[model samples]
Target: MSPLDDEAWEAWSPHELGQRLREATLPWYVAGGWALDIWHGKQTREHEDLEFVVIRNDADHFRAILHELEFFTVKDGTTEYLPPAANLPSDVWQLWGGDMRHGCWRVDMMMEPGTPDLWIYKRDRAIQMARSDAVRVSETGIPYLAPINVMLFKAKHCRKKDQIDFNFLRPRLSLEEKEQLTTWLNELHPGHEWIKKLPIS
Candidate 1:
């Protein structure tokens, strides 16, 4: 289940997402557990909902492109309909799109911090990476966030699924990626349980 679990979710598959956003020139990438599965070349576990990240400023552009969905701003535990071309409240960084036809939620769109060229950790702006390094395109032509980065975000929320994702991908992470994740966890989530488990080369 997603943040708003009560609603039905007929979320788009990663392939479906790639197909729809294929023409989108702006930076966007599949996120959450799906990203790890893409990197692993298999679905380790069933995903509750689809999630993706895009530049906050380009959200309107995406809304214009994903016509099948009706975007809504999710703020302070409330979900409100967001009109097309409307600016999201500065404080509202999350959105949920519903498919009127199916009467179900489709995707969880995350409006991320920073510019198109640089990927900035919203929680800590000081931590940054080149967009190229942060996003990796799969052989199937789907772009996804780096598994390391995904795990780092997952660390903040220790749900059962999050733990599953972390354990499943942790061993597969390269030594460099592990060190990077370690540094990030130590800095952003000091004394995080995952830190002790991440062994460095």
Candidate 2:
């Protein structure tokens, strides 16, 4: 059962939900494709699920809120394979699930791995996703994925659906963003050709 009602789901926008997330979990920022859409100023296309990157220690706090929202809790403190698939990679990942006012919504949680570049000192490695400027859901008024991170995360996927998302978002990227992303990619993967090899939707 969901804490929200039909009208509640109808009333909550993505931005409002973002506000809730901010309220519930301080310092856990939204990430992935949705974050990218916020950066780009629009929703480039449809997305299957909402993705977030939270601090590793906050998983328990996030899980508690998910329980309050009536979302199914699968993993308590670790990452693993899940039954359903979304836009993310198949490798082990941690997730929480729930039905909002609408129906089912999945939250993909990636506790920042100790990648050399993910540290706080590596400010250049992160892009700011302003919640104030994110695209709002018509029904719920919550903010969702920003566009640049959407493309970056999709670029990592290199799948047909991801290719489709990229096609929708690529033309909208600013020249400076494109150049910076290209540089970031080259630095992140060193020689990965998936971005170059994938077919645009």
What is candidate 1's lDDT per residue for 1-201, written digit by digit as tens? 223343688898999988999899899999999999999999999887999999999888788889888888888777788876577888999889888776788889998888878999887789899998999999999989999889888889878999988888887888999999999999889999999999895
Task: Evaluate model 2: give its TM-score.
Answer: 0.54
Candidate 1 clashing pairs?
none
Query: Candidate 2: which stretches are off by over 4 Å?
Result: 1-13, 69-93, 99-105, 114-146, 189-201
* lDDT tens readout by residue for model 2, 113-138: 32212322122335433333322232
TM-scores, all models, native as reference: 0.94, 0.54
Clashes (backbone N, CA, C under 3 Å), per candidate, total: 0, 24
Error of 1 at 97 (Å): 0.9
Task: Provide the lDDT at 30 for model 1.
Answer: 94
lDDT, candidates in the order shown:
0.87, 0.49
Candidate 2 global lDDT = 0.49
Best by TM-score: 1
